[model samples]
Target: MFDILVIGSINADLVFISDIRPKAGETVMGKDFKVLPGGKGANQAIAAARLGKKVGFIGCVGNDDNGKKLIENLRGNNVETQYIQIVDDVPTGVANIVVAEEDNSIIVIPGANYSISKDMIDKNMDILLNSKLILLQNEIPMEVIEHIIDLCFGKDIKVILNPAPAVKLKESIVNKIDYLTPNEHECKIAFGNPNTDGLLTKYPNKLIVTVGDKGVLYHDGNKKVNIPAFKVDVVDTTGAGDSFNGAFAVAIVEGNSLYESLLFANKAAAISVTKIGAQEGMPYLEDLKGL
Candidate 1:
């Protein structure tokens, strides 16, 4: 059985480093450009794998050079890619990422990612059930994500939903998820409330929010706890949240307490931003030793 199974998107990240973000109808010179393998699903999978967990991925990519390289990259990082499908017609998903002022803004073209349907999840039910924990993101179709959460309800598996590119979630969906990792903006959108502390209290240990550089926050039944992020020289902030979710999954599965898990995740995220790319910046188990 897999320690963690990520049911999410896989994409090629097209990164451009610029001094400033140009306004609409304006063009500006970028300092650098690079193509990197990323997707919330793939990045999380790689994150867990790097941390010494047995991770598997369930997603789709187009049958092309990008798709082939993405699969190869996953394997190189020790993520199990047997369940990833390659479709004929569509191109692999891609994100246009612009890194400016040490932060990133992205535009996603979810090509093959949108091909993930409820039927695909149904066909992979055994893989889904075999995992101890499942990681999800909003990059794929909403119905498919809802279907997986519904399928895991009352079952032994735990679900961590990272509501990126945020969308409103039903209360029923929230009730079924074991963990909800949302950034400040996503938290506001998902629950339709700007009062973050109130929401944290409502969900208790269930709601974990990542506030960049400041660290992570969650309510622990009786009280609210904030796990401060480690201090580091920041480079690219891409995939930092994905890194946290992946490391958090490993820590949880390994029987760490809620506080310990968040600490571990916080460190992982801090390390991720010290480098230049998404997957390229993910830390390994060895990288965590000194910190």
Candidate 2:
């Protein structure tokens, strides 16, 4: 049995850092470029594993060098990769990330990621049911996500859905998820409302919104609470949200109160931005001691 199960996308991030973003049909010089292992699913699995939780990842990758490296990277980070599949013809998913002037834009080619079918989940049903908590994201298919959530209903298993790359979800699906985590922008898109405060109040403890720099916000069943983010010099904002989601799952599984879990997650996310790479920047259990 695993402490955490992540059923989502795994990709190799092609990152480019440049001073100025070029206009349409133009080229510009870049300061740096690196290929790193990333994807909402893989990053969160590594984050939870680094934070001292046993994590299992289930996703699809193409049969290529990048795919092999991603699986190896997950293993190196102590995430179980046996459930990950290597598809025959599809190319591995990749995100082209351009970081310029303190902000970043991303374009994703979800090649093999889109190949994750309901059949895959059915085959892994035992692993899914055995895990204490399951983490999900929008990088995978909506139908598969809904299928998994429906399967876990009444099973006493917890689910954390990070609605990134957001799409509006059905009320039935939203009501079924145990925790709904979205960044400020995603929250608006997912719920189809501009009134963020009203949405938080509507869901209470179930809806947790991560407002960058300003920290996190949620309703505690009685009142609104904002957990302040730790003060730190941020280098790159990539994967910081994933770190928060992963750490929050670990904290919740360890039986921490909602407030305490948010604090712990905030500390983890703050620590992640202090470094450059997504998976590389995630702090281990010991790294949280002084912070």
Candidate 3:
């Protein structure tokens, strides 16, 4: 049985690093270029596995070299990849990323990620139900996410929804989620505004809004608390949120309270930004020492 099951997209990140972002219609040279394995789904799965959780991933990747490498990467991180499928016809998902002055902008080509279907979810129904918690993101199709949510509702399995690349969610679906983690921008898009009062009134303590550097604010039904981010020299902010979500799932599934989980996740994210690449920056359980 898995500690946390993540169902989302998988992609290869083509990253370009430079000192400054190029202006519109202008061409600029980058200092370095690399291709890294990434996807909201894969990143979170690896992040949790790195923290010693038995994480399983369910997603679609193209039947290609990138797919093989990504599978190897996940297996190397100790995540169960049995549920991952290699779809023919479609190419692997890819993200064209540019990092300038430590900030990044990305253009994602969904490719095989969009191939996630209802049949895939149904096929993995048993595996999905056997997990303690299910982690979801906006990378895959909404129908697939909704299907998974329907399966887990009232089944005693907890659900954590990280609405990245935010989309408007039905209240019926929102009410059923045990946790909702969204970054500042995502929160704004989902709710029209990121006013804490309005969001707290609606989501209560279930909402977690991650404000980069400023830290995270959470309302757990009782009260709202702002958990300050751990201070660190940031190298890349790409996978920081994914790291937080992954580590947070680990803590919650391990029976830690929400407050404690947030603190632990906060530290994990802080450590991630000090390194390069998304998965490369993730910290194991041993790395969470006196922050």
| CA-lDDT, candidates in order | 0.95, 0.93, 0.90
Question: How many angstroms is residue 274 displaced in model 3 relative to the true structure, after the best TM-score fit?
Answer: 0.8
List the pairs of residues colliding in candidate 3.
Answer: 205-219, 205-220, 205-221
Q: For every candidate structure, what is the RMSD over all alpha carbons to the true structure, in angstroms?
A: 0.8, 1.0, 1.1
lDDT over C-alpha atoms for residue 133 of model 2: 97
TM-scores of the candidates are: 0.98, 0.98, 0.97
Clashes of each: 0, 0, 3
Clashes of 1: 0
Instruction: Give the alpha carbon lDDT tens digit for every residue of 1-291 in model 3.
Output: 889999998999998999999989999988999999998889999999999988999999999999999998999999889888999999999998888977899888999999999999998888998999999999999988888998899998999999987998887888888999998889887777758666966677688999899999987677778999999998999899999999999999999998999999999999998888988899888788847
Which candidate leads in TM-score?
Answer: 1
lDDT of 2 at 60: 97
TM-score-superior candidate, 1 or 3: 1
Off by over 4 Å in 3: none
Q: Pick the candidate with the highest lDDT.
A: 1
Q: In candidate 1, what are the lDDT values of residues 149-200, reduced to their tens digit? A: 9999999999999999899999999999999999999999999999999999
